[model samples]
Target chain A: MTAITVDRLHKTYLVPEREGGLRAAVGALVRRRRREVHAVTDVGFTIEPGEVVGFLGPNGAGKTTTLKMLSGLLHPTSGTATVLGHVPWERDRRYLGQMALIMGQRNQLQWDIPVLDSYKLNQAVFRIPDADFKARVEELSELLALEELLRKPVRNLSLGERMKCEIAGSLLHAPQVLFLDEPTIGLDVAMQRRIRSFVAEYNRRTGACVMLTSHYMADVEALCRRVIVIHHGRLLFDGALEELVHRFAGDKTINVELADEHPLDPAALGPLVDGHAVERSATGFSVRVPKAETPRVAARLLAGLPVSDLVIEEPPIESVIEQVFEATSAEVDGG
Target chain B: MADVATRPVSGRPDFSKVSFGALRRYYVGEFGASTANNLAYRGAVAIWVVTTVIQPMVSIVVWRTVAGPAGEVNGFTSAEFVTYFAITMLVDHLTFIWLMWEFEWRIRTGAMSPLLLRPIHPIHKDVCDNLSYKVIGLVGVLPAMVLLVIGFGGDVSGIGVVQVLTFLPALVLAMAVRFLLEWVLALSAFWLTKVSALNNLYFSLFLFLSGSFAPLAVLPEAVRTLAHASPFPWIVSFPVEVALGRRTGAEVWVGYLAQLGWILVALVLLRVVWRRAVRVYSAVGS
Candidate 1:
């Protein structure tokens, strides 16, 4: 069964606007002006149960907006969505009990109390049976290294520790679907990896559907096999992560390392790489080539030089996503 | 889950039924958590109770001074003034809500978003929190009430069995009416956007008309009539008078009916306004 289905989802904010001037401020008192912001427009996608999907976008590209709608914290200006066979915006208690939405930047735990007490509140509200609550808390504690931190008040824990506890507290009910919006945001690399792996483990154990958004490409790379890309409130791409890289990553880099005996010659090597400028280092030179021509270009470089080491690499996912965003931005501007 | 981690839960509690037992369990659990939270911040709770206690003490001193050594101003002797202000302190502490002051921040910061996602209504948690704070804060407030009464020579001789019996229900009803009224007023922040000035105005009117500043009998006839016309006196002053045996017989029944009427109005207003507020936040993301 499909876990989440979003069709023609749209959210437009009627935001009041005024120029930053005394006269405009005075005039606004009598009559205000408003502008429409299309936060999410006709966004459509479906994820099967147990599917882990990356939701990628630049700032204000509607990633968070879409997640809020699916979690039933929001109702779309227009369109329909369902999670686990119930319309999300209907906010039936059953649907709410079965789903969890965690935002890394915002906290829901009571600040003055121990983290475990907050989890108890969730248990009471979600109506988790005592045995299940205990087992689930134990499993999450073991997975997230939360035993030491759960007794501390949330205000006393570091950001990373609080986040670990936050994720664990959110899962006490064993929600079937988890919407993680930058769950590792602002954490150091080690903490980020821990959270990423915990999410993966939780999904693996429970067969829960997971949709995640993050600025850190490492998070997306490790957790999401399928990715959906959105830009300017529209779906730019939705498919396997590799498919995304293959479709949007326009070029590959080829590096050739030579023995010290082979003197550096930027002039003579210019013609070998289709006359494209060759980037040089003390022991090697690398050339950018279209992904389709990497083999041929590598062969020419190998045949031309006494190469000690040779390497070919695709651009990193971060750069590829930036390229996708830049290209979409250009398209919007041009149109 | 059984495939890997642990056995399937044997008993799935159907909380969806909204039965009385389920509600009791939910509230009991929430109350425990809230009480724990209140205990964790004992200093803050003590400060809150101190503030509640101090206000009535000031009223007592000022009103007693006006009443002179053994004089009676508008039928209120110095001792009777002490009694009225002392009772007002306890009732005010029981009914006050911070929602009117902090709700705007909650909305602007998106702090209330998590509350919307929960399976249970947000008001249930708020009620639990409010009750828990009062329960914990009473540790300080109850003693302060006794001290103020004793220290100020409050006239407790007039308080009879009927008055004590009736005051319990009156105080409970007063708490309900005042909390519901303020909760609905706090929701005005959703549309008002900036509510501090409005909140100040609300508190100012509440102080004057609720008889916290002085006994309604000591105030001018017009002010007393206005206070009765509004919902303010029924919340604090009427209950205080009922406890002091100042309001007797038919007047006591009238006060109860008036409090019940305000509760019904407040409940209806709460339902309508809360429905629209959620719609606004949902339609246009806060």
Candidate 2:
């Protein structure tokens, strides 16, 4: 079933146009003018129940605006959206109780109070039964390793610990749909992985639909099978991660280990050296070659150079996403 | 998402039965949490309480000293002045609405988005928060009330059981009026980014018009006439007047009707302003 349906969502903001200096400030006080900024324009997408989708975009590229609209935190200027077949802005209590929007930057947990107290408050707001509330709290606490943190005040917990509790509080009602905006924005790598796995496990257990937007590609790579790329308030790509890598990453790297201590001269490796970086040792070098030219470059290097060890690997996913953004921007500029 | 069938979304939460239970739980839980919150920030609370009571306490001392030696200025004795200030403290604390904080938050954090998304009106949460503070404030205010009565020699001979009984409903109406008006003011956050200056202007008007600075009787005849029409006097002055037994017979009933009227007007204003604010906020993409 389609859990979320959005069509031609457009959001425009009226931003005040103020110039610098004292004179302009005085003039603004007299007659203020505004410029209309199109944050999200003609964006459209749908998500099926139990599907995990990754939303990717650069900063100020309308990723958050689109997410906010989708989660019903925002209303579109001239489009329609429905979550679980109800208009989000209507803010029906039932809809609120069933769906959760967990933002990393803004915490929902009550500060200066124990995490359990916040959960209890959520229970009241969501009207969760006592038995279900207890069982779910226990389950979420165990999953997030929040056994000790539950008793401590939210203000006392570190960012990572607090985020875990935030996630737990958001889910105490077992919201069918979860909208996570950078759920691991500031966590260390291990904590990020832990959160990613926890989300995957939660999805597996409850079959909840999740739409996550993150700057971290590892989050997308690990948890999301299908990725939706949005840029400049438009959907640029919507497909598998593998296809994204294959389509965007047109190059591979070739690493070599020299038999003896000798630095390779760039003058000698003409036409074959797109780029090369030496390991700390003078005997080793890593070279970047276009995927189509990898075979030729490697063959030439092995035959003509005193190489001992060699390896070829794909570029990182972050590089692929960066390339996607670069390509999208170029296309936009060309148009 | 988990074959979790869509539940009924629009029906009310059984206001007659389950709501009572929910309200009970809400009050108990919210009170406990707020008490802990206030305790956790005891220093800040103490500072705030001191700042809050200073003006009222100072005015009482001034009026008491002015009405010296057998002490009765415009029919209010020294003891009456003490009771008036103490009662005003409790009344002001009860009716206080931090529309300033509410508006700033709705604007700054963009948390208003989620609030606007709920099926229920967001004012319910604000109402809960308002009451939660009072629930916690009772802990400090109760003892403080006793100390003021003993130290300043307040007289409650005129405070009958009927007056005490009527005070509850009167206070409820005052809260309703204040909440509706303040909620309308909070909606300004949606239209304007810098609303603090406007909010300051509002509080200044409220201070003068509400008899917070002085009893409505002390104001000039013209200002008193204006105060009668304005909602502020009805919110603070009428309640204090009734408690002090200053108003009686038909005027007391008139005060009750005035509160109801302001409530209705404020409710209408809230609806109109909220609709416009929602439209503006959604248009601006906050």
Candidate 3:
């Protein structure tokens, strides 16, 4: 079953135009000028039940705008979207009860109260029974290691600890669909890994559909198997993570380690790989080759040089995503 | 993505239709939580109490000086002025709604987004918070009322049981009228960036028209007539007058009827304004 279906979703804002200095301020007082800003345009995608999809995009690329529309915090300027068989913008209570939107920077918890108290409030808002609420709290606490943190006021907790509590609080109702926008934006690597693992485990246990947006590539790599790339308010690619790498990442790096520490001539390995430069190091040299020619290039390197070890690796997912965005920018510039 | 079966999760309730019992439970929980949250800010409440107490105390002193110890002004003796201002303090404390200031902060800070995503309407939480603040504020207000009565020698010997009974409904309706009307006004923050000037203008009008500065009869005939034409007098002065036995029998009933009328009008205005405000917020992005 489809957990979410968004088709041709668009959001345009009428921003008041103003310039600095007294003259423009006085002019604005007499008659305000507004300019149309298209935050999201013609965005379309679908997420199946139990699927974890990464929403990848650069800044101001409408990733957050699209998530807001999916979560019903925004109404599309003109388009349609449905989550769990309900139109999102209609904001049916049933739909809201079964979905949770967690913005990493925005907090839903009452600042002055204990985290557990906020969770209890969510129990009331979502109408969770006492027994179920207790059980879920215990379970989430254990998963997030939140036993000690729950009793402290939310403002007293650090960002990582607070984020863990936030995730736990949002899940008290066991929402069937989760929309996480930059769920690990400022956390350290360990905390990010922990959150990623917890989300994967949650999905495994409950089979909830998750759509996550994050600037951290490790977050996407750890939690999501499928990714939906968006740029300029349009869908660029939507498929498996490996497929994204393969399609957008045209070149693979080949590292060759020689038996002895010696600097190698760049021209020696130039013909083996393409005309790409060979980066020399103390014990090894690395070269870039086309995805399809990596194997041939490695074979040639092993036969042509005193190579002790050789490794071929796909470029990092971050570079691939950057290339995707850069390619889009180039297309816009060229067109 | 492959198609998956639509299996209903266990232990999930049918939230499409919320029952009254569940809603009551939710409200009770929200009220309790809000009350606890307010307790954490006792210092802030104390500061607020200083302002709340001083406003009425200053008004009473001015009216008492105007009435002179033995003389009466606008049919209000010095003692009657003390009673009226003391009761007005309590009545004002109960009916005041600060959403005009709070709503602007919520919009500017993007705090309204989480509220918008919730299954319940955001007003329920605000109602709970408002009630909780008033309930906690009474701790400070009661002492202030006692001090004012002791210091000013307020005499309530003329206030009978019937007037006391009648004041209860009037106070409740006045709170409703003020909350609903001010909530409608607070929606202006959705369209305007700076609502402080608007809020200040509103509070100024309310201060003069609601008898906070002085009882309506003490004002000029034209201004008193204008006060009666607006909902402000019905919100504060009517309840204080009922408590003071200044309005009796049929007059009390008329006050209730007028309050109910203003409440109905405010309710209609709140509904219209809230819908448009949400539409604007959704369009502009919270």
Candidate 4:
């Protein structure tokens, strides 16, 4: 079943533009210049229950704006989104009860109090039956290893520890959907890995639908098999990560190890393969070819060189991401 | 997963346990923690309390001087005037609510978003914080209040045990009425980014109309009528009147009835305002 459906979502903001210097500042009091920014434009997607989808975008590319609309923190200027068969922006108590939004940069925990007290306070707000509240808190504490941190003031906890508590607090009600906005931001590698695995475990146990937005590819690669790339307020691609690479990217690199030094010039090779080739050593060079032409290029390269070892590998995902943005910008400039 | 830290305890309890037991555990420990917090900030709290209390004290001195050599002015003897303002000081301190300022800060700092997401209305936490401060500050303020009354040479001979006992409920209701009313006003923070000027204007009007300056009866009939129509007089002056035995029979009944009316009005206003305010906040990003 579909847990979420967002159709043609659009959000526009009227932001005031301020001019520098005393004269403009004084004039702004009487008249202000306003510009409209379309943060999300004609975006649409759906998530099935238990599906983990990564939302990839650059800063100011409307990732957070989209998440805010999905979580009902914002009202869209146009179009609609429904989570668990209810319109999110209506923010019905039932919907809020069944969903949770966690932002990495913002904290929901009370600064001066123990984490347990804040959790208890949430129990009252959610009106969770005491028995259920206690059982959930104990379970979360064990899952997140929060036994030691529960009694200490949140201010005393390190960033990583605090993030764990924050995550645990949000799940006290066992929400069916999670909207995570850069959840691993600002944490060290070890902490990030721990949180990532914990989330994967939680999703496996609960089968909760998750929409994750993050700049870290590690987080996306670890948690999401499918990713939707957005830029300039538009959805660029949506499918499995491998499909994304296949659709927008060229193919593999043929890395060759030669037995002895040989004078080889990449330009001397025919057609130049329309890609990059580099020497790893005096006799070693890597030649890249489109996936469709890999066999033909390998035949020529192998016949032409005294190669001892050869390995072909898919290009790195980071390069593909950079190339995707470059292609998008080229399209815009060409238009 | 079977080797969980503890057995899944049946967290449910009977109805009695939910209401009394939960509040008891929260308040008892919360009270201790709040006392320690207050002690840590005693220097700042003392300064704030002194500044706030001195406003009433200054009003007493000014009214006493206005009465001059004559024993009575505007139906109140100089000594009675002293008693009135002294009682006003204590009542005002106890009844004053800062939810307006708190809500303004909470909304502006985006703190209200987290509070809203919580299952409880943020007011419950504020209630605990307020009650805890009163308990902690009572140690210092109670003695000082008695000293001021004695030093001013006021006539409190009519304040019997019954009036003293009646004062407690009157004060608690006054606090409730003030909290709800101010909380409704604080919702204005959602719509208006700058509400401090509005707050100052509201308190300034309350000062003149509520007999914080002098007995409402002493004010012109026009202002007194307005005060009676509003909740200001019931919140401050009614409690003082009951404590000083100024109201009897029908008057006491009417005073209690008026407080109930104000409570209803406040409750309705809060519901209406809170819904609209949350709608507005949710419409805009926090």
Candidate 5:
């Protein structure tokens, strides 16, 4: 069953215009100007129950806006979406009760109250029974290692600890769908990994559909098998993570370690590789070649050079994503 | 682990079918939490109570001086003036709603996003917070009232069980009318970024028309008529007069009917204004 289906969803904001100056400020008092900003344009996707999908984009690519629309926090300028069989924008209580939205930069907990108290408020809001609330809190606290932090006020906790508590509080009712927007943003590497693992484990245990957005490629790599890439408020790619890398990543890197500490000559590689793309160290040198030509180039390099160790790798996912965005922008510019 | 996690919690009811019993429990929980949160800022509560009490105290002193040695202005003696202002203070405390400032802050800081996401309407939480603050502030209000009555030699000989009993419904309706109307006004923040000037205008009109500055009878006939036409008198002056036994017989029943009329108007206005505010907030991206 499909947990979420968004069809041609769009959002446009009417942003007021203001130019800095006393004259402009005074003029604004009499007549104001507004410009329409298309935050999300014709974005559409679907997630099946138990599927974890990553939403990838650079800053202001409309990822969060799409998530907000799906989670019922926004009313789309056009199009429609349903979560767990109910229209999200209609904000049916059943839909809201079954889904949770967590924005990493925004907090839902009461700042002055203890984390446990905030959990109790959520329990009331979601109408979770005492026994079930206790059980879910226990399970989440154990998974998040939040036993001691639950009693402290939210302001007293570190950013990582507060985020863990936020995730825990959002799950008090064991929602069937989770919309996590940049859930690991601003967290340290270790904390990000912990949250990623916890999310994977939660999905494993509950079969919940998860849609996550993050700047950290590691987060997407660890959790999402499928990714949807958006740029300039448009979908550029949507498929398996491997497909994303394979389709957008045109080249591969080959690192060759020489038998001795002697330097390698970039001139010798000739037409086999781009001479400028070759970087030589004291012990080794690395070269980039078209993915289809890696094997031929490796053979020629081995036959021509004193190679002690050789390793081949697809370019890093970060560069591939960067290329995807660059290619999309280039297409837009050309169009 | 999968089985345990996937097992639907027993006794869980559909949102549409949620029982009133469960809703009551939820409201009770909210009230308790709100009260506890308010108690954490006891110093702030005391400051609010002091400000609330000082307004009426200053009004009473100024009016008493105006009465002079003969002690009568517009048929209100010094002792009667004391009684009127003291009751006004208590009534003001009961009916005050700070949502104008709160809504501005919430909109500016993006705090309204989480509220919009919840299954419940945001107004219920705000109502609970309002009541909780009043409940905690009563700790200071009651003592201040007692001290004023003693220090000013306020006369209560005219007060009886009937007046006290009549005051109860008036106070409740007044609170409802003030809260709903102010909440509607607060929705202006959704459109206007700066609401301090609007708020100041509202409070200034309320202060003069609600008889907070003096008894409505002492004001010019035209101003008194205007006050009665507006909802401000129903919120404060009408209730204070009822508590002081100054309004009785047909006047008392007419006051109740007027209070009910204004309350209905306020509720309808709130419903309409809140819908538009949410639409604007959603459109503009909160």
Candidate 6:
């Protein structure tokens, strides 16, 4: 079964608007004004069971809004969505029990008590039996490295520790669907990597469908094979992560190391890569060419130069996503 | 890697069906957690009890001045004045909820996101939190009540078996009515960014109409009639009046009816407003 099926899901909010200064404030007493913000519009995608899909978007690009709609925290202004065959907005207990929404900025754990106690509360709320709760807690504790954290109050833990404990607490229910919005936000690089790996392991162990949205592309690259990109409240692209990269990256970077350790000049290897400049290094040269021209460029470089090693790689996902956002924004603004 | 059928999830015991055991377990678990949370800030709970004690003591002193010369005013002795304020203070403590003050902050700060994500209705957590505060607060309040009765000479002369027995149930119902009423009002934060003004209006009406300001008998007749139109008196004053043996026979029954009526009304309003409030919240992005 498809873990999630969203069809033309849309959401809009009426935001109160007012101008600065006392005159406007005084006039506002007599009347109020508001503007409609279309947060997510006609965004549609299906995430298969056990798939870890990345929801990629720039700020105000409706990634969180779509996640909220799927998690049952918000209702769409139009269209429909379902997770595990149940409409999310209905907030059915069956659906809720099978899913978890973990926001890095928000905590679901009780702050004043030990993380273990908070898990106990969840156990009762989720109706997990005593033996199962103990075993699950142990498993999550081991996975999240929460041995010391289980006894410590959430307030007492450091940011990374608390976030780790928070993630562990969210997963105690072993939800089949997880919506992780910036789950690695504000953490150190190492902590972020730790969280990403924990998510991957959890996904592997439980077969839960995971949809993650992160400003850190590393988080997505580490876990998601498929990605859905949205911009200006509209779905811009949806496909495999590699395909997204190829479609939007526009260029592929090729780095070559000369067999001899002499510095190479850019013009020496130029006119080979569509007149594009090559950046020379002590070891070799590096150049970026159009995505379609990557193979030809790499071949020409390897055959033409005393190349010891040559590697062709797609541009980073961040640049690709940014390009997607900027292009869509331009089209939206221009139109 | 996505096969949880063997390690499948468990749905919490839903309350759609009547099951006392499940109800007891859930409430007890929540209550324990809430109690632990409250205990973490024992100083705050202590300070809260102090604030609760101050208002009634002030009211008692003011009313005592009115009965100065003869120790009696409007057919009531000075002792009765003390008793009235004392009971009002206790009832007020039992029924008051602070969510109206916190709801605006929660919505603005995005603190409400956690609660909304949970499977259970948020009210149950709030209810347990309220109960935990009261239970912990009673440690300070009960002794204070005893001392106030002894220090200020509060009379227990009219007290009897029936009054105390009936007061218990009325007090419980009043707490329910008041809690639900305030929670419904707290939902106003969904639309308004600041709720302090609305909360201030609510408190002022409650003070005036609920007999916390003065006994209905001593207040003007028109005000008494107005008090009947609102749930404030039923939540705070009527319970106190019952405990004092002031309301008798059909009057006692009428107060019960009013308390029950308010609970039902609050329940209906809570359901309707809560439904709309969630829409507003989703629209507002908190």
Docking class of 6: acceptable
Give the number of the best model, judged by TM-score. Answer: 5
Per residue, candidate 6 scores C-alpha lDDT tens digits across A1-335 of 78899999989888778999999999888899999999999989998989999988888889888888888878899998989998988777767776899988887788898888888888777766677777777777777788988898889999899999888888877788999999988999999988999899888877889999999999988999998888878888888888887777898899988887655656666767778877777787788888788888888877788888888888888888888888888888899
What TM-score fits each model?
0.95, 0.90, 0.95, 0.84, 0.96, 0.94
lDDT of 4 by residue, A137-245 (tens): 7777777789999999788999999999999988877778898989989999998998899889888877888889887888988999999888878999989998887
Pick the winner on lDDT between candidates 3 and 5. Answer: 3
lDDT of 2 by residue, A30-60 (tens): 9999999888888888899999999898887
Local distance difference test values of all predictions, in order? 0.87, 0.79, 0.87, 0.78, 0.86, 0.85
Q: Is model 5 an incorrect, acceptable, medium or high docking prediction?
A: medium
DockQ of each model vs. true complex: 0.50, 0.34, 0.43, 0.24, 0.53, 0.46
Q: Model 3: per-residue lDDT, tens digit, A1-335?
A: 69899889888988889999999999999999999988788888888999999998998889888888888777789988889999987788889999999999998898988888888889888888787787788888888899999989999999999999999999888889999999998999899999999899888888899999999999999889999988887889999999999888998999889988656767766776667778877788888778888888888888888899998899989988998999999998899
How well does model 2 score by local distance difference test?
0.79
Q: For residues B119-194, write the lDDT of model 4, one tens digit per residue.
A: 3356667777788777666665666677668887777976999898887778888888888888889889988866
Docking class of 4: acceptable
Question: What tens-digit string does per-residue lDDT give for candidate 5 at A1-335?
Answer: 68888899888988899999999999999999999989899988888999999999988899988888888877889998888999887788878888899989888998878999889888888888787888888888888999999999898999999999999998888888999988998999999999999999889888889999998999999999999999888888899999999888999999989898665556667665645388777688898889988998899878878889889999999999999888888988999
TM-score of 1: 0.95
Residue runs of model 2 more than 4 Å from their true location after superposition: A258-265, A271-283, A305-310, A331-335, B1-20, B65-79, B111-120, B143-157, B282-286
Residues forming the 10-long window of minimal summed lDDT in candidate 5 chain A:
A267-276
- Clashes per candidate (backbone, < 3 Å): 0, 6, 1, 5, 0, 2
Candidate number with greatest DockQ: 5
CA RMSD of all predictions: 2.1, 3.7, 3.0, 4.3, 1.9, 2.5
**TM-score, structure 4 vs. true:** 0.84
Residue-wise lDDT of candidate 3 within B44-129, one digit each (tens)?
98888788999888888898999998998988999989988899999999998999889898888888889998889888888999
Sequence-dependent TM-score of model 3: 0.95
- Over 4 Å off, model 5: A269-272, B1-11, B283-286
